[model samples]
Target: MNSEQLIKSLLKQEEGDQLEFKLVVQKDSIGKIICAFLNHEGGQVLIGVSDDKKIVGISDAEKWEKELTDYLNSAIIPEAPVMVSLEQVGNKQVILVKVWAGSKQPYIFDGNIYFRRRQSTVKATSQEISNLIHNRQKNEFHWERQPALGVELEDLDLQEIQKTVDRSINESKLDENNRNPIDFLTHFGLFQNGHFTNAAVVLFAKNPALFIPQARVRVAFLEKGKTAGEFVDDKLLDGNLFKNILSAQDFFEKHLHTTRKFSEKEWERQDDYVVPMSALREGVMNALVHRDYSLPSASMSVIIYSDKIEVFNSGKSPLKAAELKKSHLSLPVNPDIAHMAFLRGYIEKIGRGTIKIMDACKTAGLKPPKWTTTETSVKLSFPLNIKLGGATDGGLVGAGDDNINIRIDGAIDGAIDGATTRTIRQLTILLAAIIKDEGKRIPDYKNITDLGSVRTLERYIEQLKDIGFIEFKGSAAQTGGYFITDKLKKIIK
Candidate 1:
């Protein structure tokens, strides 16, 4: 992929030593430069360029070429070394060294991991290096692959595993007769070489730490967006994914309440589809679907606040989040986890979770959640239903079950663009009024609608028409209007 353009493109962003250019005249210094970039924000070290980027091309690029190759071979295995390439730029052949912000934090070289300080490579202070290395072993902490030493597979809770599989299959709508626990595990790619992968065991193993430590999910219900706030609630989820997922669901349901009905309107219990429920549910689904099972200190997290819920899991997304939102890509960091979620009906087929999320929010009259995946974590924000003890609409307020519709409406009010909000709201009202023969057509808005004047209703109809959310027809009927393209229909179709 456009390696030259990639380097030039990154220059558009604010840069520091995170992306520094180095003139590697001495082949011996290549290893240290590799360590510096790997241990930091991951920069490009252009070999032939001067500090000012002048094209003082290397006389013999092959010296650094051999050194670069040897450096990778000598670096720690698994994570290996930064990716390096030689390219010609403006008559000068520059060796482009691309290092990822290494997932394995502090990279040790020559018995010492060197950190870059304002373009200077310095050995890490003892305390700093200890902390850095301590945090580096996230993805390397594969518990299932290691033996529990004396522990056997019998150490697992078979009965619980059976229950989990049954529940997952039921939730997923799979044929019960065809899916056994082992079979389901195999289908999810959790089973490998006669044994379950670490991820599989995290989701199903009785005591995952028996062989693999750090296989638990972390859930925190916070206030004020910080951990020190009133510990709204906290939990360390264990057992298999099935049990853990369902348990997480139950935990929030207990703390987060919704109204039995939104309005005194008889259609209240009729599934107006409040977004918080969907948000809470999807947040867990995303965590389970994307979390990196190999990461130790980096674990799955679900943070619930008074105003919003933020869900995070380990691993940088392979797809830019903008692409994920636009395309139907399922680049799962943990395919086994994603497959398990798919089978359990936690994730939709065709990798259409984002689409469903958008659809659900539109249907619920709530805003779709925003997606942002970074190098360290994947985050989703579900807007809070109630703010400051009152809905954003300024009607009702309170926590738990008393305020559901308010939150639902608030999300829509806050998230969508102005044009979209107006168009969708009009469609919702019009569709709600339409049933059997009780409603008017798209162009008949002025008469049948209850939101005020004929002229105002006509303006709304016209706006909807121009926006492609509505179309009109017929026999010179001035007041005729209809929801030709409601957001929900548009989303699904």
Candidate 2:
């Protein structure tokens, strides 16, 4: 809908959590409302509207829009994402200020955090502010922020901490003035309230495995069709997160096959590993940075198979399996750890690690990486140049296993070979949505597939039903929806 129609529709509604009406543009009141909206789910502020749902418009909306935009940019901490526009109602103009939920929370206005309480904007309480801070850190009760019991300055490796500070300064990620280990720890929120946090221990502890056993990584090399326990060689890497990362790289270099070939065209020799080291390094860093440290009994693992390698960690990604293939938000399970990893030049803050892994594999003429997540763990698999059912002539293998490839190939050839590319893409999207959740109704599929008409979506759905990929269950009046059939589930498995 256009802005005029949307404003007219909102005019009939009362003030609520996401809707606020003001007769004038007061910087103080408007700032509070904007801050509250950012702290909560996003909202819209309609200036020149009264409390009783009157549409008495403003005199000059252009001036108000620019002024309010400037005020919010300077007043709100961290510079909230807000849009100010002038919209014409029936006979007058109104200033519409739209705010989205801030990824970085606890938006402060005039030194106080504001939150929306139903239809009112008020200053946040101490407990509410604490919750916002924790939520901004991406965990309700962040394990990394907790005090490390029995850990002191003596327990941490002072030299390693100093080296990190130096490296960060050289990388222009930190100010050179704060060169002390204590200062570095305090600057990164690793030291708080006169006590060292668990993050500090994980990053600088002399023997982190002694205190946090799960901080270690287990690397193993298994033959074809072998279990994890029966490994040809394995090692339990210890020390800090950075140390373990480097040690894992060393293990990969020693075990993974490498080839050196002379290129006459270039007058030089080229060397490469079976899989790109960049992809493996990224996978390992992701496993460490995103691991669930609260699960003290669980540890990360790097398992090498004859045809693939798997990096497994005890934490579920906030993103869905299909979402990883596209652009998505970066919702790190451990924000503190992720931030430190970024500063050290080990990872990026944006959610591009998976994309980088896939791109690197594709550039190397290998199959794209796959991400699989369970209720409590996430595993990333990288394929190698080994044929499963055919002769191995040093060629990249296909994406999935033999059974899945056969089933999917047969289904596609029999059902969708004659369909248009757009229809096939829509079918893939529909199947992904249903696999993610079977209770999705027709409307949900339409929204996901971006189909403007239900009739068009039903045609695609009918095709799937005819192919035995999905089946309808229950009645339309009751809890009825399209669900994946056993044939599709077997192929997925």
Candidate 3:
């Protein structure tokens, strides 16, 4: 409901198990009420309201909002989900602190368990604490442990299973005795009671989509200003988890451009992709390892735009968005899947993937990647531009006598006046290569430019040729190649 409607409805209710009213911001009293609400059914605490239910607004709503939010974030134990906002009730403003029923219950406050007893908040009795703990444990179910109804060992890829065993053994993540595929699966809890679990199928099945269609990753490459339906290229990848990861990386390599920077201090060259490849790998791996496969229609996706790359997964993160930036506990939604990935060295057991992504970006002089969460999914975005180093004047510069320093800015159009740094570099490299060798073939251009595909190289060559910078100098039957035109040679010193 809208804030106005919600506040109007809440105003008519008396303070009880699901609602509380306070005349001012009493930090201790509000903490107890929020803790009790988390332990029981979720509730709301409204500040600036009298004990008689009058809307006596606070003196400064903005200041109270931040003060209460900071208090809740710090005072609460285990970091429960609490939302604090300012809402208007009639002509006055009130602070509303909304708390959700904690999935990990027994939320503690000041070394005690608080309980909501009808209309009052008090310390929980011993029996109530025991019941909360017992209920939490009883309701915890791991979906990955469930049996795949018709899946068999033969349906899994034996070679991939063997590879995992070898890699895990080499990495000391698995014992030598578990080298066999069946033993490896059993050790990792993928095989129970002589039946294959869903994780086994997800990790090693030849065609996981046949059994669980949601076990797929969709990738798309879109040019700047393009809609979702208008894609430069896209693919739906389905197979074992390892295969999908590798395939997605290959797709990224195909579409993403690499930038080369020459370091004058080291007298060496360094090459980096537009977006850090390691960060993208971590993003994809995290999406797969933590995905909620129980939602049959939900799947992961990687959308590549000209300016940013977005990696989206099916489930909301266990921690809040703010918590992800700081140190938090590792709470994997699919433990079995995460465990297998860990053993294979694809991911670590500790919660450091987000940190790794941010670090990679910072080291590469790019803006830090952003993580956004919603009710049903989480998305990680890597902006392609916004560099922190190199040219600060928003124009290209020369690093050395023979090296040109190209830095990507916010512009993405491919025109001469507004071309992306990568595009300009490609065109310049192609022309320089032609100048060095008078008759350069397409293969030679591909080798020198290191563009992902022959089609991309040809596009660059065509752009140069159309601008009267180069020309073809041979017939169809004879040996032919592109040669620099006099128009281009006149500019060369």
Candidate 4:
């Protein structure tokens, strides 16, 4: 807003979190107010404005502005960058000093650390001070170790604990001792004095999203980058970390393509993912276990684009991407969560997740995953091998050991009367794509179609197969695939 509009807006509002009115620049107290604003969400101090929201102009704003700048340079511990400008309010001149929210927390003035709470500048409590220090130094931050309020032992999923124990025992990492869930939690330090830590809440809570609103993984299948465009499959994966991980994996598996090749000796079909599932899982688990939960507004996310998938978590890595690409130490943001994930066989070699993902991508003959970061978030993007209408030696189907070309035929017109010719053509194109490769199940077909229910699509497939236009393959128990018949090819011709 312009100076006049800004003044009018500021005058209309009361002095609160983002704004404070001062009649004059009090040299001693002004620094404290600025420090408080810097420590909290940065705010504006309007000089020449009265307590009652009157626009009483300052006599010498230029003089006071000079003094404020000089004081700021010399008074604060770390210099706070601010914008100080004199704006004309009617006949009066009001100085607007705007201080932005600083990345450096606990900005100190003189000997005290100040914080802005509502309209007052208060000294930070010991715990608040500790939190500030921890926020600045990520390695020292233990947000997961902090107790999750309103959480109880019963809130945890007993099945999760059992699964962890079972995995540990099978791996011989733990003895098959029948320790109770509570005792096991205590042993891992997730159960503190009469309370569950945030780590415990994340790993085992029936719905951790209830305790931590931003704990869930947000997955979006976007047509365009970042925007939810045509063909979007946006969903928030909630519940405990394990459940979210599984849900995210399911989402990826549905959207991603697979390459199929037959083994000569065994006559067995081997399916290779466009992006390695292991690498994707590692990325997801790492995001879940190491995200900065202290950032109450931020949540982890898996965004899938047509050509790529991005997995993001709040909080930048302590180690740089280049450093991680080489040998580097792992400094997990949530150590307690990471520890539990490690024990559960979710994460391996604490610091090797990045290297492994890169190696996996290379092994699959795909481009290396791109790692990018901002001050508040880390993102890993894995590019997809196939684009729209892009064809490889085999398409998105893995049936038995043969490649087949099946032409769309009018022979199914009398047999299947429900669907339109356009719909049938679309279905034919989809099945033909599969036939070019091996074969695909209903889920893969649903992904290709991306518009109908599984049961509905299954009926159509059955009708086509029954009419002798398509043939079925693979085990009946499994979601087997369909191939166009040679007899139908003659009818179309």
> Highest lDDT: which candidate?
2
For model 2, residues 276-370, the per-residue Cα lDDT tens digits are 89989999998998998777787799988766899999987887877776533445677667766765767642455776787778755567889
Candidate 2 is scored at a TM of 0.55
Tens-digit lDDT track for model 3 on 1-493? 3345556667788888888888999989999999998888778887887777778999888988877767775676644556677877678898888765665578898888999988899999999999999966753446677788788877999999888788766644455787888887876668878888888889999999988899988999765434435687778998889999999999888766556643435544466676789989998998998888987888899988755789999887887777776433444677667656765778642455776787777766666788899889999999755211222211122112133222221111123554444565556555655665567688776765455489887888888777677899886456888987776555443
- Candidate 3 segments whose C-alpha is farther than 4 A from its true place: 1-141, 226-228, 263-266, 386-493
- lDDT for model 4, on a 0 to 1 scale? 0.69
lDDT of 2: 0.73
Clash pairs, candidate 4, are 399-439
Q: Model 1: per-residue lDDT, tens digit, 1-493? A: 1335444554453435655666655544666766776676555566675656556766667666656655564463323324455666556667766554555567777777777777677787887677677765454344433323443356556676566578654543334653576665554445545766666566667766655555677787664445346666787876566777777877776656443333333433333323446656776777776666656667777777655667778778776777655423333566445544554456643334665566666555555678798987788777643331222221123343243333333433333445343344443344333311233653343333444577666665565455454444444455543534565244323
For model 2, where is the 10-residue window of minimal lDDT?
A: 388-397
Segments of candidate 1 deviating more than 4 angstroms = 1-151, 159-194, 209-213, 224-228, 260-268, 271-276, 388-395, 400-493
Q: Go through the candidates in order and give each one's C-alpha lDDT.
A: 0.55, 0.73, 0.72, 0.69
RMSD each, Å = 15.4, 15.3, 15.0, 20.4
Clashes of 4: 1
* Structure candidate 2, residue pairs in collision: none
Q: At residue 221, what lDDT does model 2 achieve?
A: 80
- TM-scores of the candidates are 0.47, 0.55, 0.54, 0.52
Q: In candidate 4, what are the lDDT values of residues 1-493, reduced to their tens digit? A: 3457668877887888878889987867778888888777778788888778888898888887766766674587654444466888788898877665654567899889988899998898888889877775652236776788899777889999888877755643444553578877775667878888888888999998899888887998765444435555788877898898899889877766544433344444456455789999989987887788877788888987756788999987886666766423444567567656766777644345777787878765567788887788888989764432232322232222123312242333345655553354345445555555436777776666442588867776776677777787778778666766787656544
Candidate 3 lDDT trough over 10 residues, lowest sum: 386-395
Model 1, residue 299: displacement in angstroms? Answer: 1.6
